[model samples]
Target: MILWGRPSSVNVQKVLWALSESAVPFDHHIVGGKYGGTDTATFKVMTPVPRVPVLQDGDLTLWESHAILRHLAGGVPPLADQWMEYTTSTLQPAFLQMFYELVRTAPADRTKDAEALKATFLAAVAPLEWQLRKTQWLGGDSFGMADIAAGAMMVRACDLCDPLSPQVARWYEQLQTRPAYRAVVMTSYEELRA
Candidate 1:
């Protein structure tokens, strides 16, 4: 099995963390976005959308982070379709909005509109805070795809979202305690941070 994407991307991080949690062994082919290399015809053929974190396993190919997570979670304990919905329906949009706020805006614009962006991010977190308060994991006590999806944002919130909520902070802290998540972050991100 192979996963293609730059390690720094939050979308790509979702799949890598899932692979770690599942203890699935696979090779990673660095590609896409800032890391570039998406110009290749072969890479484009693998993912119709030509996006990062495309998964190729034997004869199968998949793209979209949530969809890839669902495919990888097949029959895995405590991760199922509903968890995928939690990712797509609940997490992805808000996360993407936050990502755009940080990545697509100029620093001057962000400074001028900090309050608005913060409000948007805060509003986005309310439901997540509510859901998290109800369960240790997004899927209610078991770490699964929902947690993986949300956790991806949680990892990047300090950069993407402003005035991170206490609830969100606690949730991220809890997630970081997981050995699998720690392994993925350490292997994929910490070294780069160094």
Candidate 2:
């Protein structure tokens, strides 16, 4: 199996974390972002939309991170589909907004309120935080696709949402102990800073 995308992308990080957790042997090729190549004829055939985290396995080529996660897991776990959808629709947008407002925007041009962005991200976190308070993992117990979907963002909240609530802090602690999380999700995102 081969995976293509730069690690700086949140979407790509999700797939990389999942693949690491599953212990799947796959080759990673850096493409997209500053690396370019997404517009190449080879990449066009692989990625219909010039996005990262594209996976090629056997004769099948899959784009979109969530679809890659589902395929890697063999099938969706309980509540995983729902949580993943919620993440993409809700949590992820807030995260992206926060990231862009803070990281991508130049300080001179950063007229957007940082507090408001954090609040938005926090509001999105409220529901997940409530659910997390009730269980060790998003999928109830064991770490699964659901955790991979949402958990990947927990580490990136250092500045935006530091000192996480009790349950989230504890859950993140567990994620930190995993070698895969450290190897993938915990890596520097400096490449994404603009």
The C-alpha stretches of model 2 lying farther than 4 A from their native spots are: none
Tell me how candidate 2 scores on lDDT: 0.85
RMSD of each: 3.8, 1.2
Q: C-alpha displacement of 81 in model 2, angstroms?
A: 1.6
Candidate 1 structure quality by residue, lDDT tens digits, 27-146: 999987657777798887887676798899899999888878878878434534565565577556766665565665555565435556556666766766776677776677777777
lDDT by residue (1-194, candidate 2, tens digit) is 99999988878989999988888899999999999989999999987798898999999999988899999989997677888999999998998888897988777888888888898888887777787887778878778888888888877776566637777778788888989889988878887777
- As a whole number from 0 to 100, the lDDT of residue 55 in candidate 2 is 97
TM-score of decoy 1: 0.80
Index of the highest-lDDT prediction: 2
Question: Each prediction's Cα lDDT score?
Answer: 0.71, 0.85
Query: Residue 20 of model 2: what lDDT?
Result: 88
